[model samples]
Target: MTLAHFLHGLRCASCGTLNALWLDLIRALVECHQCGQTALTLTDTDEGRSL
Candidate 1:
């Protein structure tokens, strides 16, 4: 859902990379391919954060 919503994907704040692929087979957090930083999740106004 996250990946589908943000079709172009989010840019990594640390390394500045665009990650648009499947986050993981079991997880939902997308990792930075360039910096290898696993720092991303889907958060709503009331739900806080999701992984």
Candidate 2:
């Protein structure tokens, strides 16, 4: 997805920068652009919780 489609409100664990999350659906990874940190890994249980 484009940068405009990045998920906001997420803070980078390494850099403490906010609004820097990029969700990669294929890999089920949520990463921070500012610090290159893998903040979250989407699991089957997480999918249910979001809804």
Candidate 3:
């Protein structure tokens, strides 16, 4: 999967730490690298993430 967009220096909602957004497969997700927590998950495809 390739990154469609990235929010550099963004804050995580779950961990309250700086994070980056990346595209995994068809899903756009944000994880706190410091805390290893998934802060958010969004559908990157027209029908959402799929196998």
Model 3 residue 19 CA deviation (Å) reads 3.8
Report the lDDT tens digits of candidate 1 across residue range 1-51.
233333266777777667643364246566656776774666577676666
* TM-score: the better of candidates 2 and 3: 2
Estimate every model's Cα lDDT from 0 to 1.
0.57, 0.72, 0.56
Compute the lDDT of residue 31 as modeled in candidate 3: 49
Best-to-worst lDDT order? 2, 1, 3
The lDDT of model 1 is 0.57
Candidates by TM-score, descending order: 2, 1, 3
CA error at residue 46 for candidate 3, angstroms = 5.8
Per-residue CA lDDT of model 2 for 10-38, tens digit only, reads: 67778888898788776667788877888
TM-score of 3: 0.40
| Residue 17, model 2: Cα distance from true site in angstroms | 0.4
Model 1 TM-score (2 dp):
0.43
For candidate 2, what is the lDDT?
Answer: 0.72
Q: What is the lDDT of residue 45 in candidate 1?
A: 73
